[model samples]
Target: MTDRSAFPRRREALAMLAAAALPSAAHAAERRVATVDWSVLETLLALGAAPVAAPELLQFREVAVEPAVPNTITDLGLRGTVNFELLLLSRPELIYSSSFYVSSEPRLARIAPVERFSIYAPGRPPYEPAAAMMRSIGARLGRSEEAERYIADTEAEFAGLRERLKPHAVRPVIPINLGDTRHFRVFGADSMFGEVLKRLGLANAWTEATSYSAMAPVGIEALARMPDAWIALIPPVPPGALDVLAGSTFWNALPSVRAERVLQLASINPFGGLPAARRFARLLGEALPAERGHG
Candidate 1:
């Protein structure tokens, strides 16, 4: 018992001094990540882990993110052409990417522990898949709270939107990715868009099949069945393609077209990721009318 009380106070002071001298606990545990999509990068940032470099999709470079810690977000270029050397030089601890690209590229594993999740499946809806990706990413980052919060927020937003647009919820919606090839794509039961629409209490017009697939090219004749349904356009198409389609006889005859129900959306990134989920919800809200009117 020789000066034990003094020893306790001294130990506490030493601990405080050590903590003060050392970097913060948050900084000590921080991780470096490299990702393909800004959406995924944003999710990690949202979860408090920002990537040192990420692909700046030409269209999405305008996004505003502030307090911009780790400001150097390198643009590694686009799909199928990642700058491996650039990414490797950064020495990221983890690289998050879409499964499609990872499945094709073998060198990703060599750089670091690569985590693959799809955020841009061509014909796939991205909500549940994105939600699942968020969970996986959160687990990897040891941010379980973030994952739960994302899911809860998404569910809450969807529920509120559904309730607000209940009258128009029953209206059938179609997802089409118009392009030079004239790809006719629609979200299936398992797609992210499907999950959002399902959550919003809306119905998918296409019942050809459930799995994501390239729909058989439909001409004006096919529009007879559900002409009154709304058409939701996805992206990657030239800006004027919709105008071209609109002028075409095949597109002009559809009841939905005639009724002006076709809604152009900037959020058809697909691939089932968190960004897709959030964007889908916002797009759905925007696409649906605030108040249903006689059509």
Candidate 2:
């Protein structure tokens, strides 16, 4: 009548049920995960696992190197966005993404277990979040060793470039996503691109505050200030835009522009995971002028 008499029996029954269910729970935890960003996809690939689906596989088609996993991953659209309906249909075990788009859309969790982690956060200084993300994702992917190796290799390569560039006295470098000859977004010290520049021992010309990328748009008026700076154009644009930039006075008048230091890199997501960082190094080295070729 006191009801306390039934509590002991209920606890015993629940304990028994939990003990019986532990094995099934362990099995359920082993489901594979898929990611939308190329960085995460690269991390997973390095970890010896492939996602069920990924967007823009062709962009990193060389790195992925494996045939598509049948009935698993489906390419929905571009990076930073996914087709929710297709995502639901794909039935990923887990979905990984950056903080920007993921936090903006919480409804994705309804389809699968969406693990929210900030690969990069807005307004944070020093850009430590990116390296933290790499280490965290590396641990998750069981490839922390590979991640360390990559980090070391990148640092070494950067050091070599620094030595090569020192003779010429490395100057500030402004990496711009050339929207046009008149307007451009200059990368600040907060971006991965900026970090790559820093690794090469080049200072970022823009010292102003930045949001996510620490990137702010400026007009050609600012170009006059960075006479010794080299401009790295990003996203290797269409032929028409290239031609227009090639012919514009705004592009022609700068010191670095005249010295043939300006170069364009193909559009690859510089944010996200380890592969992104590695790819950045590879792309930068390829785009930069050789020691003999420089002034």
Candidate 3:
């Protein structure tokens, strides 16, 4: 039992099937694809392809926010928990995924061919892989031209951002996403944020190796050690973490905070590809200059 009674109603949804990823050279129509990975989904959007279906779209909206997910693409559910029965009914021709969900690939492949990509590798920077994925996916989608254009445009944007930041690249940048006031996730050299910061001609404050490019659930005391750094706080701020930080003497007394060197960056897909790199570079471009003398 998978409750076959619901199959007939969902059959109509099959026609609106999402596009596949890294498809074969045949043609776009031959492979009906969907994706459970946000990075893949966003890459599809950036390449101007109609994604078959995307997982955790609502959350993606809050975090990744660029090239924009359309209202037309269906939300399959969270990345870890997808609607397998719905996928089965739709008869997906393929499924685009990433290393983040490798354990789920077998299950996903049961419904359709599963093509997986990885940007985050142990001790390796994700930027290059992300660019390669864009081109590869674009070629598979028969949109290689568009992929090159996007890559060029993203690189040009990064170049412009680097030039814009040159004068004030004064301090090393510490990028973080708050898990709560007491603990947070810091992006290291292998992270998209850290690597992009390097691309933007800025130094990353967290020099140590990280477990898969980030170190999480770490105490605030760690951040206090980077006295001359600019704290780049990535959001969706943990509810009232800011309020909690506002009153605590320990928070206010931190050298970076006391010097007003914190840069509040909008949320980004920390392990993402080109679109995320572009979004992050843009966020830094806007935030850093605005905080110049004020810091």
Candidate 4:
């Protein structure tokens, strides 16, 4: 029953399969793309233009939670550190990045052509810039129409939220992420949170100019100045921050804290793109309705 003639053909088929899996200089027309930037990665997901490789999907899934990533993509490793070997194995035809990886651009170019996008600028809100980045990435991926549609969809959602949240728009929202017991980072008008809150027709409580996006390690005492605003406590809350706050006199004395006007929101990446704007807006909408407390 052993057909010896088929043996040679079977071995040849196996060799071809192995070659296809390797990072060789060949393709079936579809190009590979890799990115170390979460913003780029999430934008790609929104456009249905998944990259061949991305970094930190594990953590990204928890924080950004929008336009879900595909299951087939390769994880290049941690976002803080790039895994050069894994990236090489992925054999991306192109690599998309943000300013955070500027120093590594030269090295990245060695493996594939690299394109960098910038969204954060000191003075202006990044909403338009973020949308521009999406359009740019979509053009690169040959998904320009999809990108425009996604941007339109996101804007439409915000427009709808602006109407839905009109009732609870009485008080401004002060968004803060606790760094520890003593201090927290506040989102200013230039920040994405501040920008989204504005788009939703709600005022941002913190009006001071931020250095870039958020001002970190701000003293807790400063919150006492704005008593009527709603304090939106963002998570990744330090190990025992809540218990610590429960026992502190100053924390209890803050009117927002005492009146239970604090809205506990999920982790929304402060530097994300349109998808992030939608995520933050949706979370606020769901949590701001009746029975809104400790959420």
Candidate 5:
């Protein structure tokens, strides 16, 4: 039989080992992170991780509505000219970015570990890359479970939207960002908006070739070609775009415009991940009933 006195010593030893295995308080406090990409920032927020700093924080607020950023977080400045001085001063434990800013990685690494994530790749589905980025960022931040849950929840949300959109599935929709009265950026099969449309069981009307941005700049005449398709314009529409187009003979001639089959959705981040996809899905669901009546 074991000695009774030795049992107390064994229990004390086990407790000490467990305590040593746990993360120290100081180490836990060092989890602060920063991001240079808005989509990355949004994904981190959705995972319940608040980045200490992010680029273009104000613009992110203007464009992205969900997964809101807190005012306490510092802005790292514009995307094209990130304030490196401010970023270094923040002393983040990690810096998240994308390949578009790969040139700055070496300099950024002087302050913290820099992890680059890509949400757009040649010949790949938009949602796939976005999901991969979410999982990767989540794992790095120790929030893998949250990432998976968010993806699953988003899929469920899309599924519900798909069911609700069944009646209007036959309506081909074209999503565009109206650049001006004369020009617009139309989304194609490779865009995040296109993926959301697919998941919602809606057909995309713009099938033209495009760069990795998955959109092409086209004129108002382009809409005439898609006569049967409804136009879903992303808002904060260029100032006076509607008023200007209203008086133009070209805009009035489109069969869709004549039928009033146009919808103005809330601002959506075309480059965002699961959160953005969910937002687009909900927007489509809300607008479909009206679209059907107009069609």
Candidate 6:
């Protein structure tokens, strides 16, 4: 027969032990995260953390090529107007966003801890900010080592790509996204694609100042200015934009188009991090001809 006083002490001991084990058990459960930006989602996936939810997932699939998001994750909504009710129901442990969406931080904090990551700043290279963002997010997600490895691997890959693309090092290339038959968004030095071009030892034909968005909306006449430039078009070009451009005398007049010095890359997120940089490098290497001649 157990004494009542001893029974009470045993119960207290059991409770203490259980309390002590609670933290470890909680740590074992993967943290649930929700990302409000595609870049954050890409970085999290690269770090081996699957977010519980992300915004614009369908659009992300169309633009972002690598580090695919698993179907288990929920789509909260678009960037500007996320479904707060659905977000609450998801019960995320953390919410990651960008500085562009800071207005929603206070509201997001009510549900979970909110972290805002800034990837672009004045007077800094795009890759510098992107690498820093990866490390910062990685440390928060307990993936610091993986983040370091990713940066190192990207650098190694870039070095190899540089050697492989040495023949076209002097070639000036203009990367453009078609907005319509008459206008296109030309990527310049401030863009992620610009950084990739620099890494490959290629020159950007469009030297004019561009918005922080890294691209400038210009008329088709702009392409005519860089007659010696190789035009690289991003895939999934606006529906019928090319067909319309093909008929335009302004488009056919460009020396690049006439010489067949144009390359089309597989879908790549220009705003993504290390994985995107690697993808851009590989694709450009494959697209460029072995010699100075056209592909």
The TM-score leader among the candidates is: 5
The TM-scores, one per candidate, come to 0.79, 0.75, 0.87, 0.86, 0.89, 0.86
Off by over 4 Å in 4: 1-31, 290-295
Model 5, runs deviating above 4 Å: 1-30, 290-294
lDDT of each structure? 0.67, 0.64, 0.83, 0.85, 0.83, 0.81
Q: Give the per-residue lDDT digits (tens) of candidate 2, residues 224-277.
A: 788877677776353577788678887787787787777676565645454555
Model 1: CA > 4 A from native: 1-7, 10-30, 37-39, 59-71, 118-126, 180-183, 210-221
Backbone clashes, each candidate? 10, 2, 3, 1, 0, 0
lDDT of 6 by residue, 117-165 (tens): 7775443457887898899877777678889999999999999988887
Clashing pairs in 1: 119-271, 120-271, 121-271, 125-192, 126-192, 126-272, 127-192, 130-272, 130-273, 227-256
What's the lDDT of the predicted structure labeled candidate 5?
Answer: 0.83
- Candidate 2, residue 78: Cα displacement in angstroms equals 4.4
Q: For residues 138-223, what per-residue lDDT tens digits would candidate 1 score against the true structure?
A: 77767878788977987888788888867875578876665443545565655666667777888877766544433545443544
lDDT at residue 223 of model 2 (Cα atoms):
78
List of clashing residue pairs for candidate 2: 52-73, 53-73
Error of 2 at 163 (Å): 3.3
TM-score: the better of candidates 3 and 5: 5
lDDT of 3: 0.83
Q: Model 5 clash pairs? A: none
How do all the candidates rank in terms of TM-score, highest first? 5, 3, 6, 4, 1, 2
Q: How would you encode candidate 5's per-residue C-alpha lDDT over 1-295 as one tens digit per residue? A: 7689998899999999998999755335325888888888889889878888889988888898878887878898998789999998887988999877888888889889888987766545589888999988777766778899999999999888888778777778999999889888987777788888988888999887766656546887888888889899886588888999899887888899998888889998888878888888898789766436336
Candidate 2 Cα deviation (angstroms), residue 41: 2.6
Candidates in order: C-alpha RMSD to true structure: 4.2, 9.3, 11.0, 7.8, 3.3, 5.5
Model 5, position 273, has a per-residue lDDT of: 77
> By lDDT, highest first, what's the ranking?
4, 3, 5, 6, 1, 2
* Candidate 4 lDDT, 253-285, residue by residue in tens: 999889888789988888898888888889988
